[model samples]
Target: MTPAIPLVLLGLLDAAFSGFRAYAGSDARIRKQRFATRAGLRGLAVGAALLLAPTLTAALLLVTGDQARTYNTLAAGGLGYLLPLTVYATAVLLSLAAYFALPFRASTLAVVVGLGPLTLLRPLAIAAACLGAVLNGGGGSALLVGTIAGAAVLCVEPTVHRRWYHHVQ
Candidate 1:
């Protein structure tokens, strides 16, 4: 089992990057300069995370040592960890693409932004990534539970956002 410290740190970094990207993308037109910087930083952060994933996982394994069951599970074990990383990476790319395309596709961006708030998406991504970490300690069932929970959140997020935004507007 990896120590809680590294996992918490990783989660914090993930959440920060995710939050930046979602916020920048959502308001790129209003703040192009800030959006560009944020996008660049987010790209760098995601790249570094992917590059160091193996090393970090190895280090966690070393720190934890090969003990009982679920040793080295999160980092080196299965698709559980990798899947969330991939999802996050893909989301970053897609969000950037959408931001870039927003000017040419205002309707599309509007529809998307109208459907759900970008703010919520950021934390959802973080939650998914943390669930991936849970795979390290808990196992496949943890990943499954995370997936289900995430799906539930995703399903309900838009309605909550829409209602809130409607009132604000």
Candidate 2:
């Protein structure tokens, strides 16, 4: 089993990146630059909180021995660990595609077709990834799967946003 420290560090990085993305994508801003700086800082704080909180909680749970069995069962195993990562990646990819193929009014049929697979396969993919990780063994494999998934998600965001803005206007 991988040491808890490294896993905690990885989780922290992931949280940070996710928080940054979330903040950058908020709808309240008119000028991207103006809000970007503030959002970035906010994201950093939120990410740190997320990463630290979970790690601390898990550590405490481990010490207390009163840990939630169900969660432990799911997260302790390799497959369980990978499932959520895979699903998250699949969902983000699908959302990106959906956003890019926007102007739903114009491409209603295409949008439906594109989103169809995502809607159906996202959950299954995540589940399978998690299962694969658990069955295969945890460690770097889980992180790799998650990184690849996150990258795929990132790739589509810009295109989707542009299309969405165009459609809105």
Q: Which stretches of candidate 1 lie above 4 Å from their native place? A: 1-61, 67-71, 102-119, 133-169
What's the C-alpha lDDT at position 118 in model 2?
Answer: 53
Best by TM-score: 1
Candidate 2 pairs with clashing backbones? 78-133, 78-134, 79-130, 79-134, 82-130, 83-130, 87-126
TM per candidate: 0.39, 0.38
Residue-level error in angstroms, candidate 2, position 97: 6.0
Overall lDDT per candidate, in order of appearance:
0.47, 0.47
- When summed lDDT is taken over every stretch of 10 residues in candidate 1, the lowest stretch is 160-169
Which whole-number lDDT from 0 to 100 does residue 143 have in model 1? 51
